[model samples]
Structure formats: structure tokens, C-alpha cells
Target: MKVGVISDTHGLLRPEALAALEGCALIVHAGDIGKPEVLEALAALAPLRVVRGNNDLALLWAQGLPDVDRFEVQGWQVLLVHDLADVPAHLDQGVQWVITGHSHKPLIERREGCLYLNPGSAGPRRFSLPVTLALIEVGADALVPEIVPLLAANPLKATSR
Candidate 1:
């Protein structure tokens, strides 16, 4: 199963991001969506799972939207959260991956026995950071994820000398 991971959009959705997420079975929004339309747009692509971030507190989320959620996909347990600090110490239910987005920096790390992923800020650029997103593919026995950066669709050209 292919899962698209994104976060910290802050209301700007790029067509590149949408294209990268096409054909994904599920889309995970880490937070800071900025508006309901963001989710609506993603829902058009695939089933979406979301967590309310600090910036999203003012928005209305579905009932029982918790700080963390455990999702089982293809027999692998994946944990979804907005903040890494909120991670539970023990995984009694068996978690293979921990997905979170808060710092707006894309990350793919395998710590201990689990994977930690952050799709970064795919919306308006923050500081000097590049816009990026991630795709996670869970095979029957293993999980593979890739972080991809979104480049400007049009690059500036140099003036004639």
C-alpha cells in the first residue's frame, strides 16, 4: 500500500504536491492545514487521516481527534501524530513506524526498531527550507519511504549579457 504523508501546509497547496500524492491509498496530514479546504482537496485524491496541530486548534476537527493515532496497514502498525514529544514510551500494541510532523523538516529515520518520518512543509516556504513531502510504501514484509522535495515549476532565467 502506498501512503502519502504531508504536513504544515498553512493553507497553500501546490499542484506538485498533489501530483506526487496521486495513486496513494491513503494520505496522512500531520497538521497546520490552515483550512478545511486543504483536507477536502486531499480527500479527492484518497482516504485521509489527520491530526490537529497547534496551529489547527481554532479549526473544527472530527470528534475524538486525539494527539496520536495508531493505524494498521498491511499488518504493520503505524502511529500518526503531530508532535514527536507526545510519543508514548511503550508500544504495547506493536508499532512499526511513528509518523509525525511539527518542525517542518522532512525526516526519515529508523531508531531502535521503528521508523520515524516527517513529510516536511509542502506549502509556503518557511525560511530557507525547501518544500517537500513523503511517500511510504508498505510491502507484505517491510516498509519503504521516500522524501521528495518540490522544486519551483518555473526557474528564473539569466539575462543576456
Candidate 2:
């Protein structure tokens, strides 16, 4: 299964971001989503799962969104949260992945038996950070992740686990 992971889209859903997410089996938004239209646009692409970020707390449309979401995909337990600091202290033992956003920094790392991924900011540019998102290929045996840069000048590259 191919899963698209995106975060920190603070109102601006760049056309490049939507293009990169095309063909994904599922889309996960880690939040800081500035508006409801963004959700509508993403859901149009694929099934979407999202967690509300701190910024979303003030939005009436985001009131019903959860701060954390847990699910299993291809037998891998996944936990989604907007901020790493808010991750529950006692996580379920089987959770294999923790997806988060908020710092506008793209990252992929494995620690304590779980893979941590942040797709950076797909909204407005932040500092010099590249606009990016992630694509996760889930197979029966392993999960391969690739970070895709949205800027034309950066080119596309794959980062594996």
C-alpha cells in the first residue's frame, strides 16, 4: 500500500503538494491545517486520517478533530499526533510508527522500535526548509519511506529506512 503523509499545511495547499500525493492509497495529515478547504481538497485525493494541531484549536471547523489517532495499516500499528511532545507516555506496545509535524522540518528516523516521520511544511515556506511530504510504501515485510521535495529546483529523491 502506498500512503501519503503530509503536515503543517497552514492554509496554503500548494499545487505541488497535491500533485505529490496523487495515487496514494491513504493520506495522513498531521495537522496545523489552516482551513477546512484544505481537508476537502486532500480527501478528494484519497482516504484521509488527521489529528488536530494547536493552531486548529481555535477553528470552529476543527473542534471535532482529535489530537491523536490510532489505526493499523497492513498490520503495522500507527499513531498520529501533531506534536511529538504530546505523544502519550504509555503508547500501545504494537505501535510501529509515530507520525508528527509542527516544527516545519522534514525527518525520518527510527528509535525505540518505532519509525518517526515528519513530512515538514507543505504550506508556506519556512526559513530555508524545503517544502516536502512523504510517501510510505508498506509491503508485507517492510515499510519504505521517501521524502519528496516540492520545489522544482530541489529535485526528487528517495530516503529509505
Model 2 over residues 81-136: C-alpha lDDT tens digits?
A: 99999887777889888999998998888878688889888989989998999889
lDDT of 1: 0.82
Candidate 1 lDDT by residue in tens digits, 1-161: 88899999988889999998999999999987887888899999999988878788876653345667788888888898888887787754688888898898888887777888888898899989879888877788777887878874432211110
Which residues of candidate 2, in runs, are more than 4 Å off? 153-161
Computed on alpha carbons, the lDDT of every model, listed in order, comes to 0.82, 0.89
Q: What CA RMSD would you report for each candidate?
A: 7.6, 1.7
- Highest TM-score model number: 2
TM-scores for all candidates: the values are: 0.88, 0.93
